[model samples]
Target: MFGLKESEIATLITAVSVEGGGDLDRVSIENRFARATWSGLAEPGDRLAGRAIQQLGAARALSAVVEHWNTERFAAELSADGDPVAGDDMRQAIDRWMPRLKSDTALIALRQAARFGARLLIPDDELWPERLNDLDWHAPSALWVRGTDAALAGIVDGIALVGARAATGYGEHITMEASAGLVDRGYTIVSGAAYGIDGMAHRAALASHGLTVAFLAGGVDRFYPSGHDSLLTRIVENGAVISELPCGSPPTKWRFLQRNRLIAAASLATIVLEAGWRSGSLNTAGHAAALGRPLGAVPGPVTSAASAGCHRLIRDYDAVCVTNPDQMAELAPLVEREIDVSEIDSELRISSATPGSEVSAENVDTVGARSPETTRLIDALSARSARTADDIAARSGLAITAVRAHLGLLELDGRVTETGRGWKRVAVAKPETSRVFRSPSTDSE
Candidate 1:
């Protein structure tokens, strides 16, 4: 649309438009265009784009989004020939190259984006959200947007609701009621499209006839967690599903974590309905707080494991405590909003190197490098003090023998010195090499 015959050039424009100004920096523009281009062609624009991206990194690419791209900047930096051969010659050379992809593949992406009930929204477009600029290098190239464009028209009124995929019944119920209530109050709901809470929220919003948006961790063309394909189809017709990645990218764990930040940043407020101490939803909450968005958590029953994270946030992090939709909707803004934290003291305070940081199952020694089952057993025991093998097995969903084997390893590692009574996880000063063996979960805690 911007006079560049190459689709990558057009996509580059979409990426650049997210920023506020219209200036184009040929170098940076070329870099972003190269990343978008992704073809085998050896065009000059592609070569230049690659060099810029290599020099700037994804972070810089994100910055260029909101920054003006200046053609004059290109003119000032040209080589001595005055012909601008290095720069101008490259631009001319790119014109000689064919558009990178097969027409069929390109058409498919466009058609799928449309059929998915999504419109390709570029940065310069009227409907683009200015707040997305907050993401910096993390910002999207272009958003495949669905649902009513009118829903996005009102910027000040959207809310993001997110939580676990393995949601408990209580979590799903809370999501449904809160999403419905939020919609009733004229607030658009935003979430991912995973099972459990995310799916529940989107479905509830649809049921209530409220506007909702789903942000995916992959391409707009290929929906990950394929079970949600039909569910997503409904959303495209009734709400929106968006992605910052190019069309057809697969959803990886890293992408999923990255996607949460968008959910938090896109809305005025973010409410974490239910999460475990380790649920990925907390990543969204962290993003919300960092961005200075209003953050709230539902008060779950104290005994419920799913609510443990929520309780921790309200008690420790000072997240606004919400009971129902009304409380969530009317959360009083704290002048100095403290972060809500569900991080458990036991989880945080325990040390892998400490002498007591060990558990003794019947056969397994689980102190150091082992399977996930072993890790799960250790975490369960450490979090709750001493427990029988059966209890540990039930909580961790591991075979009894596997749990026992991990316990044996922990004892041998000396990371978990055994007690006649049972085993416990503790911390101790350790050698530098030993530090590498520590669990990441322990470090985060």
Candidate 2:
């Protein structure tokens, strides 16, 4: 049960940390290492892992499990922390995690990832995709990503294009068009990197020179469906290939199902180009529906079994019937708008309007009237990059403690958002912007 010293653990975490090998403070290093350890110890979408980490902090929760804490101690600790779980649940969770609680294995994964230049992203990293949080307790403990910063950030505009692995000619054709068209319109293509429709989608996106992200069921170190090795490699070079599992892990049926949830959640929308009644792509669609994201289905020949799933979704699941890429793009909100201070309606008020003016409000609730500290925090935030609270504090001249507190307030008001281990400013509506709203049912001119 003995573990690495704090300093040694910090070194390993910093090696794979998405902050790109910068010195991290004691608290952050411990937390990131703990999350990476948890990712290996628990299966993807383990609610107890998330809940325990939420209540006890990753480092503390990991320690409790490593020490073989009794059920009573576990329940008591969680209860005192304000979230009480039954002893039976704690006992089961501890049992489920203990078998895989190999600290050495986590160390190996970290080293392997460092060798491959893979990044370990905890919830606090700026590269972490925030939409995954929608999965709540089932969200991944950490993410293993192999790609550039821009490729990862492109997730904000992602739209999932999923379908049957045994895709038909018609299905591949639809996927190609949808993928390329969406790319042309500034969408990032997302998929599981499987054959048929998923492959076609990625290929089309790449052909159009657009960003694409693949969510793997296994480690980013090992590409699944070995035949697609070249395709995934290109993705790593030009887009991103991501996973929740550690470096040496292999793909399994359950992991694939869990991986589908990520493809659904990370994307702004999910479109099923082709599927059979029991197709795995349906799993992705179900996750999309559960998340309340826009779901689109491409229609095909009535006689084709591959199109049955799409029909089922349209008839039974209320999925919008989308025939073309333009229709599919209509599934999500166009973009995150940025507004000029002068564009604030009279009620919102800029008593004195000026172009590109920054307003200062003492009240945190007031949108443009940022407090001195909040103004400094926002000024420190970049629309294109995410910064950890530590970095934000250093840049904004606030203490790390204060930076975190203000971030919570700012996040609640839609002023800033969490990405992996950092934060980014959310773009408000820009001034003098003209938008033509189009209904999904409307025909393209």
Best by lDDT: 2
| C-alpha TM-score for every candidate | 0.56, 0.75
Question: What is the model-wide C-alpha lDDT for candidate 1?
Answer: 0.57
Candidate 2, which segments miss by more than 4 Å at Cα? 81-83, 336-445
- lDDT, candidate 2, 161-277, per-residue tens: 999887889999889999999999999999989988999999999999999999998899988778899999999999999999989876654566678889988988889899876
lDDT by candidate, in order shown:
0.57, 0.77
Q: Which 10 consecutive positions of candidate 1 have the poorest summed lDDT?
A: 357-366
Error of 1 at 351 (Å): 28
Report the C-alpha displacement of residue 11, candidate 2, in angstroms: 2.6
Per-residue lDDT over 387-416 for candidate 1, one digit per residue giving the tens place of the 0 to 100 score: 565544433434455657777887787645
Regions more than 4 Å wrong, model 1 = 1-118, 154-156, 332-445
